[model samples]
Target: MTSLETLLRNTQDVKVIDRSIDYNEYIPLDLSAFNPELSKFDIKCAVSFEEFIEKHLTLNDAKVAFGGYNEQRNLYQRSTVFKDEKTEERNIHIGLDLWIKARTPVLSALDGKVHSFNFNAGFGDYGPTIILEHQLENQIFYTLYGHLSLDSLKDLEIGTVFKKGEQFATLGNAAVNGDYSPHLHFQIIKNIAEKFGDYPGVCSKKELPFYLENCPDPNLLLKITA
Candidate 1:
């Protein structure tokens, strides 16, 4: 089978906080307009992305984009880890963002272990992040949840066990989560490079190709409108 087929085969139905929609549900927002390169103006026209896409946006657009490749928008692009002097330009967004209000509960899409976690704080940072590892159809992979409340990772133990569709964390607001509109940055990583709690959600133009392969569209697992 082809990689596309593999991805389709691996796609899983995620248990949303209180999902009322059904399969192949039509999301409210037309985020196809949310390309990585678009300026704040373009993004706001769509909806206020809790992180990179700044400015005022409306709630008409619910159910944010999960995973799908785009050449313009960097989900975590504007988040800064520290003072500008402390780090270089922040550009890469390593995960798929689920745009919504803060405090939304994030659920585990599959049975897995708490592989690792940390509070990746900084300007435009992840705030609190969690990574869960799963073995579906004998395929070993991981899911990374970023932009969560600090309390979310307070007592999480690495390698701790969590069942599929479990409640793990809640979406945080801009004050706690990396400075952005409220949203959950979801990502699937094949190899974590020994990294815990934090990973590059976006990559430079030169590195896009590699990051794309390393981080597949989370839609495979979440089945979100990518």
Candidate 2:
């Protein structure tokens, strides 16, 4: 394992969502093209897609539906942001998603200062996003929180310090959060490269290897297992 991965794994009790919800209540959700169930729903519509999420949670008897790291999904086909005639479709999701109802409390994964934040307004884009810069074991990295409520960005400033588990934001609904189900798109970025508030959460197959290396699996920190 790399130094960053080891540092993340060595940490304890990391919860980015409501602290009251235990990891046991979190269930894995498959939004990939390989999931045959996705074919049944008109996922392009946020309302319909949300209904599907609600049903999935109900059936599994879980509170939160999570996953989608390095998952290739067909859901992005409706958005020109992921694909246009000139570029290859960016269908692979590189972040760990925590699917839940809107306005759920979002916490900081570790003590860090705000590197950047923005309202990336677009279809299939991260609505309100925040990236926190952290340093551990003399290594600096960043954690990105996407699909946040607008209120989360209110009164925010650069270099804002947030302690681990501190409530810094709330989840955004479909109307604001890229017109999809309410979820926190969390990623661990080793190198941000001049990007502010926003980073490419989806990548084409051709660019997968680079992204996969730069953005490691967030589960190494969350450790929410099956």
Q: Local distance difference test, per candidate?
A: 0.64, 0.95
Candidate 2 wrong stretches, greater than 4 Å: none
Runs with alpha carbons beyond 4 Å of true place in candidate 1: 1-8, 20-71, 74-94
Model 2, 1-226: lDDT tens digits are 3499889888889999999999988889999999999989898999999999999999999999999999999989999999998999999999999999999999999999999999999998999999999998788999999999999999999999999999999999988999989999999999999999999999999999999999999999999982
User: What shift in Å separates residue 80 of candidate 1 from its native position after superposition?
Assistant: 4.9
Clashes of 1: 22
Error of 1 at 154 (Å): 2.4
TM-score per candidate, chains pooled: 0.75, 0.98
Indicate the residue-level lDDT of 132 in model 1. 89
lDDT of predicted model 1: 0.64
Q: Show the colliding residue pairs in model 2.
A: none
